[model samples]
Target chain A: MPTIVVDVMPKAELLDPQGKAVTGALNRLSSSRESGSGISEVRIGKRFELTVEGPVTEELRERVREIAADILSNSVIEDVVNIDFGDDAS
Target chain B: MTFRIGVVTFPGSLDERDAQRAIRLAGAEAVELWHGEHDLKGVDAIVLPGGFSYGDYLRAGAIAAVSPIMSEVIDAAGTGMPVLGICNGFQMLVEAHLLPGGLIRNAHQQFIRRDQGLRVENADTAWTNEFATGDEIIIPLKNGDGGYIADAETLKRVEGEGRVAFRYTGLNPNGSLNDIAGLTNERGNVVGLMPHPEHAVEAGFGPDTEVAMRSGVDGLRFFTSALRALAAV
Candidate 1:
């Protein structure tokens, strides 16, 4: 079986309010440290793990990529970072 | 014959009853439709009322955008059936590709609820024919993900074509680009907005008016406009 992973993130040009809020909270938490945690940023996104029962053939890879780009992420606002198959199951 | 308008109720829909009531008050027969239903019960128009459908699991309106009945709505909208999406319903419209642009979280990262002022930008749509262009109205607005966004080209196209149906007047409640509050499709049959027009159909239970609080009935025009549209057809 081949396991596939898809990561989705807001387009860089668009604002990520949730990610910014999380980063702001982190900055506040680390402000009092003698040496700040040095955690300068956080960019939040979604990840999906899909498993296939058979080998990850070229056709399967194409189909998975299509789904990841067209359905898993909205092209207008979000983008798919990558689609990778585990075990190099090509 | 009474015009029949369908109010779709998804699993988390919170305003189907109010939409149906508004339709009835507009002298139309209100029909309740379901997300799972394939048929629209021969409705003359459709209203996708607001709510956090599917609990905003993946994204606001993302799951419900692909619901079974949406295919039918899509087909009808293509044939010029009037369809109005409010709030979360507007999110679904964008998610389903029934409308342009996308809605993201508010800039302040907080859920906002308040009476909002809107300027009617294009009154030729099936849902806005009752209001003259440039009319200002008060309606209730409440949402978390309500900021409207689009690429520069798309924004220019919508604006140049006069597809913007309404715009925020007094204040940009959610930081929507260009102060847009609502929009219509090219044919003007499908409209979507962040405000809750269904909540303002009746006096004493809607947004505040200049004379008294909760006396606004400006939202009634949307339903009445639908009635006029159906009558003309």
Candidate 2:
């Protein structure tokens, strides 16, 4: 079995308020520490892991890419990255 | 012949009945359509009302975009059938690639409900022909993920072609680029907007009007415009 993983996130140019809010929360938590706001940026996104029985062929890879680009990610506001297949799949 | 307007009701849909009623108020026959149904009931036009479709899972309107009924909607829109997407329905349209751009969470990151003012930017569309290009109207707007975004080139193209159907007047409710509130396809049939026009179609029940004791029934123009478009055909 081969496991395919896809990660989607908002585009770099777009404002990600959700991610910003999380980063703000992180800053508030670390304000008392000596670390002193070590984090600079944070981005939130979605990941999908798919396991398919049998071998991972080139055709299957292409099909997964197509679906990832067309359905999993919206080109207008989000980008699809971290598309990889795990070799250790049972 | 009475124009048959189909109002699609998906799971979690909250405004399909309101859209149907608006269509009826416009003197058109309101037809109820289901998302799981493959047929559109031979409707002359279609309205995808707003709500948190699929519980806003994965993304708003992402699941409903590929639902069974959407295939028929895409086909009908391609053939110039009038299709209007409101709020969450607008999200589904963008997800389905029937309209340009995508809607994301508001800049303020909170659900907002208000009487929004909009200016008619393009009146030649099937859904906006009843208004003059510069006419300003008020309608109810309520949503969380209503901020609209698109690439520079695409925005320029839509703006250049006068495909921008409506623009938020006075204030940008959700930080939409260029104050855009609604858009139409190249053929002027498919339209999508973040506001709930169906909510403003009836008097007394709609938003308050500035004219004192009047209802914000400006949204009636959208449905009436659809009928006018059909009449010209």
Candidate 3:
């Protein structure tokens, strides 16, 4: 079984309200998006790990990317989900 | 016919009920779906609710994206069925490649939670048709890994095309590029946002009930929008 990890990223200028809310409270309300953080943009994403039994090869990687692209994502807003397939596992 | 929408539940999903409630509150039927199930139950729209699907074990919605139910979701979204992904659901959309970009950990390195302000950037999507452009809405936003990332070129394209659906207001909670709270595809049917809209569909129970009735039913519009879209079709 080969362990796999997948990551999802968002586009720029898409305000991550959750992310901004946190930055505002950081340092006990010292700075934030409201205070004019002067930060024009932010990015957000998630990581996934999967255990699979497969050979580690370019074909396998493409297959995994295809899985991430078609069955795993919405292709429009998301750029590309990176899949990390680990070495073959017993 | 009344619009029917499906709420997908992965093994570790936490917002299935919330999503169902939001759907029902919007005057649409809510269909419960499981990750292992391959049927859509004739839903007109689909909601990938927020939660720690697959225990967030594999990058939030990574595993759930490949679940049996997702096969149907892919099929439905392709035919122009309205699909909305919230928070973890948003992550799954990105992982599933239905949307662009990915979500990462906050730069502050912590699970952030709060009532969030959002400026509706695009009101044309099936899920957002009820809203108007630049409308400000408040919803509960909570997540650990909600930072959105994408290559520079992709970022430019998403913005240049006016695909951005929502932008954070008041504060940049996470280190997301351009403060993007949500986005829609070119056709404006599929939408993915990092906020927990499900949590705001109820009254005092939601984060932003100060303005409306105790129902805190503002979020219901998301579902109703889809229902109206289906009806128009």
Candidate 4:
């Protein structure tokens, strides 16, 4: 079995409040330490692992790409950042 | 003939009953439809009520947008069927590409519930023919992810075309761009908004008015507007 990894993230121009809240929490924790961590910003996203049987092929990759772009992510406010096929790369 | 409006109930839907009740109060037949079904049951109009469908998984309304019944919804909307989406239903509309733009997490990062004020921007749509442009109304709004966003070109085009159905009057609750609260499609048959209009249809259960508490029936016109639109056809 091969696994196709799809990563989706909010658009860069759009504001991400969830990511901002996480960044704020990290900054507050780092401020208490003697050596402050250099954290500028953070953006949270989603990763989907799709398991498929059989060998990876160009046709299958294209099909997965279509699903990633259309079903897995909405192009209006989010982008499909990466699609990775591990070990079974064609 | 009595107008029959369908209210779709998806898995985890919380406001389908309220929507059906609102339609009935407007002197129309309220038809119950399911997300997993393939039929619209010969409904004259459709209402997508608010709720956390699919538990808001994989983004709100994302999964439910592609459910079995949505294919029929998309087709019906294409042929000029009147459809209204409220709150989470609005999310599904945008997710299904029935309307433009997208809704994201609120800028304040908190779930907000309020009696929101809205100014009618376009009164010619199927769902808003009862209103006049610039008419202000109050409706109850509740949501966690309701911030509306779009690219520059898309925003400009939507605004230039007079597709904006409503605008937040007093305050932008979720930091929606341009204070846009609702929108209508090009054909003026489909509309989506982030407020719960069904909650405001009953005089005793709606937002407070100047005369009495929870005595506002502004939402009743939304259902009547659909009836009016259907009668003219």
Q: Where does model 1 sit among the CAPRI classes?
A: high
lDDT of 4 by residue, B42-161 (tens): 999999999999999998999999999999999999999999999999999999999999999999999999888999999999999999999999989899989999999999999999
| Chain B TM, every candidate | 0.99, 0.98, 0.95, 0.99
B204: Cα error in model 1, Å: 1.3
- Full candidate order by TM-score, most accurate first: 4, 1, 2, 3
- Sort the predicted structures by DockQ, highest score first: 4, 2, 1, 3
> How displaced is residue B35 in candidate 1, in Å?
0.9
- Clash pairs (backbone) in predicted model 2: none
Q: What is the lDDT of residue B88 in candidate 1?
A: 89
As for lDDT, the candidate ahead, 1 or 2, is 1
Q: Which rank order by lDDT, best down to worst?
A: 4, 1, 2, 3
The most accurate candidate by DockQ is: 4
Residue-wise C-alpha lDDT for candidate 3, range B4-121, written one tens digit per residue: 8899887778889989988888888899877787888887899998888877864667788778888888788888999999998888887877888778777567798988888999
In order, what lDDT does every prediction score? 0.92, 0.91, 0.79, 0.93
| Residue-level lDDT tens digits of model 3 in A1-90 | 667788776544444454555555563444544576455444457666666676666877777788777644544445454666664431
Question: What is the DockQ score, from 0 to 1, of model 4?
Answer: 0.89
Candidates 2 and 4 compared by DockQ, better number: 4
List RMSD in Å for every model shown. Answer: 1.5, 1.9, 7.9, 1.2
Give the per-residue lDDT of model 1 (tens digit) for B122-192: 99999999999999999999999999999999999999999999999987988899999999999999999
User: Which CAPRI category fits model 2?
Assistant: high
True contacts kept of each: 0.75, 0.90, 0.10, 0.90
Chain B structural similarity as TM-score, candidate 2: 0.98
